[model samples]
Target: MSERTGWDRRLRVRADGKGLVGHAGVVLLRRCADQVGLTGALAAVLPVGVGHGWRERAAVVVQLAVAIALGAVNLSEAEQLALHHRNLFGPAASDSTTRRTLAALDESALTRMAKARRTVRRHVWSLLHLRPGGFPWLSVAGRRLKGWIVVDMDATVITAASKKERAAATF
Candidate 1:
């Protein structure tokens, strides 16, 4: 199969087979260290809930990197897509393992991970690059368009089973 080219390269996306986690993560992390203060930033990043021995916990990073690589980008999809690609990462994980890992990364854990990594932060801000110019594609009105971005958020409802938990704020 020849490498993807032309418009297919632009809109429809696919992985390069190079693992997105280790190498891509190193690149991204370095960019982050440059823009934001490294120690302070890393330290400031809260834990994604309790770390689980780095074995089962490895899923956190793998899932995240792959999801970002594929542009699914949301936590739920991140969890789902991560499961879908587990074999690509090596060592086939049973559907149950995937479910358990994802369940462990439940809302609270995801919030902590997002908080600790400042996952929502811009790469330019995190990497220290001044945000890119000329509307991602460069057209007449593209200049005025929002460039290089993805907006994400999460919400949960605590049923009557838990009276201690309550909606903090209203939109």
Candidate 2:
């Protein structure tokens, strides 16, 4: 019998060695964990006590994963990519599981996380040690030139849609 085998190219994990860190999957997992609580992540479910009912948090991650993959519409297709690349269990999520999980969230945890993130951006500016215009978005032209920063808003692609209509408002 030959000493070598076809499995030589296969990757193997070291049971006693350290595992991968800072990988995309690990980073995404950390973000999801922050969205829900760490405890919620381990459980992959939680109750917001907001009258919606029990909510499963893993779907939050799966849905985002699907979006990041791009062009994944149905749950099954999303699950396939999630399973192959991220090694997250996709086939385990059926339509019903997804539906119930969604129904369970009063508002999407993902959306809440997004909103919370926006608020957090302003927190840095609130620090006492940082004076006005010291945070860097401000320029040193305060006394010599325009002190205010101009913010431009455009909605060329943003739209508001409802179930009754595909797009209620578009810009």
Candidate 3:
């Protein structure tokens, strides 16, 4: 079929009981996350009954992941997703709530969380039919070579808009 361009079709608004979803794609991604057993894994790792009214660990992690995937630079930006479907998406977590949740986690909790994350990663990789081994071969300048991936993590200087404890010129 030939591709059609421009606004050939007219747009209309339907005021039905159906709600509008801003990050609709994220909902699909959440389903995939659920399929990969992320929720159960996170529940096993994270502390229980810690959040009085705060969202659960699995929900918070998925929400944060969705926000990050949608190009949210900070935790406060999660409100953008929550605003569209507050009822369907569950309770919206404030920036302070997210911060406090992370801060309250001890070393043991952190370790468990990491292990759970690793399990989720492995499950996702398996679902995508990706093998765990050496890097795939890449063609460069018409020559095939086993590609090697390198990651560099370095601290950079940034000016904070507000005063923060231990805030320095560089991290």
Candidate 4:
């Protein structure tokens, strides 16, 4: 188990073609969050509930984010994280707890969360800048842009062979 988060870290990966665990990618995602200090940063900014048996708010938020990344559409679905992955995930917050945590976030709290995210982003970029090649450059239309991160949020449309109810032919 990890000393910082108390999550199990005994997972082993092998190509022996035996004892496969599905959705193991979540472990890597969780580790990345921990290594990047995102979990600690969010915990420092968020309010910790007063009383025993209360899980860390930041942990719950991170778990929910991971659940979403794993295709969970709602808080109830987030419970899937604890269903079969208890050993890997430790104790996950209940859906009601998640709802309450989200509901308790006011404007100020949201601002703090945003600031925390920005801080982490800056830290990560600084680390990237220290790499051998420095920050990566982007080339578009024969124009090379350095020291700038370009995010493309273009929407993609996929055509379906057969149309179904409430399903668009192309999306």
The candidate that wins on lDDT is 4
- Any idea how many clashes model 1 has? 3
| lDDT scores in order | 0.45, 0.45, 0.65, 0.79
Q: Estimate each model's TM-score.
A: 0.34, 0.33, 0.58, 0.70
Candidate 1 lDDT by residue in tens digits, 1-171:
322342233334257744333223333433334335432343343233445433334434544554567675566666566555443343333445445656666676666656645653654354434446522332356353445443333434444343456745433
Candidate 2 lDDT score relative to the true structure? 0.45
Colliding residue pairs in candidate 1: 35-128, 45-116, 46-116
Candidate 2, residues 28-118, lDDT tens digits: the string is: 4434334434433423334332344333455444454544455667766655444444332223344455656657656566566555445
What would the per-residue lDDT of candidate 4 be over residues 25-137, giving only the tens digit for each residue? 77777877888889999999999777888989998889988889999999888986645566666777889989988998999999999999899989988897788976657
What's the best-to-worst order under lDDT?
4, 3, 1, 2
- RMSD of every candidate to native, in Å, equals 15.3, 15.2, 12.8, 6.9
Candidate with best TM-score:
4
Stretches off by above 4 angstroms in model 1 are: 1-54, 58-61, 64-88, 106-108, 119-124, 128-142, 147-171
Once superposed on the true structure, which residue ranges of model 3 sit more than 4 Å away at CA?
1-17, 50-54, 127-171
* Steric collisions counted per model: 3, 0, 0, 1
